[model samples]
Every structure is written in C-alpha cells, then in structure tokens.
Target chain A: QQPVQSPQAVILREGEDAVINCSSSKALYSVHWYRQKHGEAPVFLMILLKGGEQKGHEKISASFNEKKQQSSLYLTASQLSYSGTYFCGTEYLGSGANNLFFGTGTRLTVIP
Target chain B: EAGVVQSPRYKIIEKKQPVAFWCNPISGHNTLYWYRQNLGQGPELLIRYENEEAVDDSQLPKDRFSAERLKGVDSTLKIQPAELGDSAVYLCASSLVVSSYEQYFGPGTRLTVT
Candidate 1:
C-alpha cells in the first residue's frame, strides 16, 4: 500500500529547515526518499532499512522507525535549489516483491 | 556510468491511439521498474523486471498496458487504445540488483492524451 505523507506542502526561506513525515499502514522493509523538480526525473536522496537507522545526505537527512512504520526526512539549512516535490517510497514487509509503493508527495518551495 | 535512459521525453496522442515508450537501464543493473506518475501524485509502480523476467505486474492495467524487458537490459512499455485518463509521466528506473535500495531514474516520458 502507498504511504501517507504529512504537510502536503511547505514553504521555507533560504537557510531554513523543514521536516516531512511519511507513515504507512502496513509494515515496512525499507523507506527510500527522492526529490523531483519540475520537468525532471526523481533523484534518489537516501534509503533507510528496517533497523531504525538514520542516514544523511549533505544537508538532508532521514530517519526510519521500523516499530512505527514511519520515516521522516529532514532538510536543514535549505537552499533555493531544494524547491521540489519530495516523495517517500515504501517497501512493505512480507510482500515478497521488490517493489516500492510511493506516497503522494510533499511540495517544498524555498524562497530567498 | 550513465544513468537510466528513456526516449520520447514528451508525447501527445488522441484517445484510442497507441503509444509506446522505451527505456535503457544503466549498465550492469539487474532490476528495472516502470512507474506511472500523475500530476500532484507520486510515481506508482506499473511493472518491475529482474533481468529478462517480469517479477511484478499486478498494478499494471493488463487490459491496455503492457511491458517487456528483453535481453535483460532494454525495456519497452506500450499502451494500446489510450484513454484521456492515461495522461501521465512514465518513469523508468534501475538498481544494481533486486535487493538494492537506491534506484536511479531516467528522464520520464510525459504523455498527454487528448
């Protein structure tokens, strides 16, 4: 099943910080994060496996909570180029298939 | 070290027409995926392939949508008798293996049906 993302949209000024949350009804095996700018492909940011591990990518980081079936992405000191739609792809447990079910998305706009 | 590649970055077709999109995954990648993304929504899996075999296609609309990954490298997705609601971006992605976490995506094909 697809995950649910909170704060459907967010607006931030340069150097600000933002948090996007993703929750799934079913158990998860991994949570993958990606960002897509207008007219471009979604680029991989990072992935957190089921161990409740947290990973960072530059100023962006994400945390996965296996017990709660939730993941949160942290964008600290956001930049103008960070304006885009963020999506969380969830791989459900016991699905047996290596497929990702993506959430609706969170629109983030960083202004000067 | 090229990323995934897709053809026909944009396409416009009328209802009841046929359309096809092509994809070439990064070299040595063993898993390929096809996703359909609608406006204001996240990409949804349409099909997935491991090497030359289809591993998952339950979400694919079998009545009108079909896909193939031949020779374990290139793939093609076809939609026959397209409908207006079929307008969306088709994204192709690949990973080193089925269990690989990170998937590299290609520039998607934006389909507009009139």
Candidate 2:
C-alpha cells in the first residue's frame, strides 16, 4: 500500500520552519524523503530504516517512528531553494524484493 | 559520480502511437524501478528490477505497457497504442538495495498523448 502524506501544500517564509508527515497502513521497512523542483527530477533527501535509523542530506532532516508506522520531515531555516514538491516513499518488509510506494506529495513554497 | 540518466525529456504523440522511454541507472546499483507520475499527483511504481530480472510488475498494465532490462544497467519502458490517459511523467530510479538505501531518480520523460 502507498503511504499517506499530510498537508497537500505549505507556504513558508525564508528562515521559517515546516514539517511534512507520512504514514503507512502496513509495517514499513524504510521511509524515504525526496524533493522535486518544477520540471525537474526528484532529488533524494533521506531514508529511515525500520529500526528507526535515519540518514539524509546535511540540510534536510527526518525521523521515523516504527511504533506508529510513520515518518516526519523537518525543514529548519527554510530557504527559497527549498520550494518544491516533497514526497515520501515507503517500503514494506516481506513484500518481496525492494519496491517503493510513494505518497501523494506535499507542495512547499518558500517565499524570500 | 554521475546520477541516473533518462532520455527524451519530452514526447508528444497521438493516441494509438507507441512511445518508449529509456533509463540508465547509477553505476554499481543493482536495483532499478520505473514509476508513473500524473500531474499534481505523486509517483506510482510501475515495475522494479533486481539485476536483469523483473521482480515486481503487478502495477504495470500488461495489455499495453511493457518493460525490459537486458544487461541490468539500463532499462526501457514502452507503451504501445498509447492512450491520452497515459500522458504523464515516466520516472526511473535506482538504489543499491531495497533496504535503507536512497533511490536516486532521473529526470523523467514527459509524454503528452493527443
């Protein structure tokens, strides 16, 4: 099943903070975060393993809660370059081979 | 140092025409995936490949959509008799494994069917 992302869209000012949430119905082995600018490909941001292990870029951060089957992405001191569509992909264990199911997405606009 | 790459950044075709998109995964990556993204929506997985084998293709429309990965380094997705509804962005991504590794996406091919 695909993960569910909250807040269809968000607007923030430069240096502001924002959060994007992703939840899944099934147990997830990993949760991935990606950002795509207009007319561009999605860029890898971070990935959180089932054991609550988090890894990502230096500027973007995310946390996974195994108990809740959810993950949240936090953007601090947002910059104008952060404006893009954010998506969270979920992978389930026992689903066989590595496959990713992505959430709808969260459109973020950072005004400078 | 190079990321995933895709060709034909944009395509325009009439209904019933065949359209194909090509993708080259990152070097040394064994896992590859194809996804379809509609406007204003998130991407949906179409198929996945582990090496030269297709591990998952349940989401692919077998009647009109087909994909292949011969050498495990590059892949191709084809839509025969393309329909207007098939117009969307076809994205390809690759990862070392399905576990905790990040999947790097390539600039998708945007198809417009008339």
Model number with the top TM-score: 1
lDDT for B74 (candidate 2) = 99
lDDT of 1 by residue, A1-112 (tens): 8899999999999999999999999999999999999989999999899875589999999998877899999999999999999999999887855589899999999999
What is candidate 2's lDDT per residue for B1-114, written digit by digit as tens?
A: 999999999999999999999999999999999999999888899999999999889999999999999998999999998999999999999998756688888999999999
Task: Give per-residue lDDT, candidate 2, residue A103.
Answer: 93
Q: Write the per-residue lDDT of candidate 1 for residues B40-108, one digit (tens) a residue.
A: 999999999999999888999999999998799999999998999999999999998787369999999
Error of 1 at A4 (Å): 0.6
For model 2, fnat equals 0.83
lDDT of all predictions, in order shown? Answer: 0.93, 0.90
DockQ of each: 0.79, 0.76
Clashing residue pairs found in predicted model 1: none
Q: Cα lDDT for residue B48, model 2? A: 91
- TM-score of candidate 1 to 2 decimals: 0.97
Off by over 4 Å in 1: none
Clashes of each: 0, 0
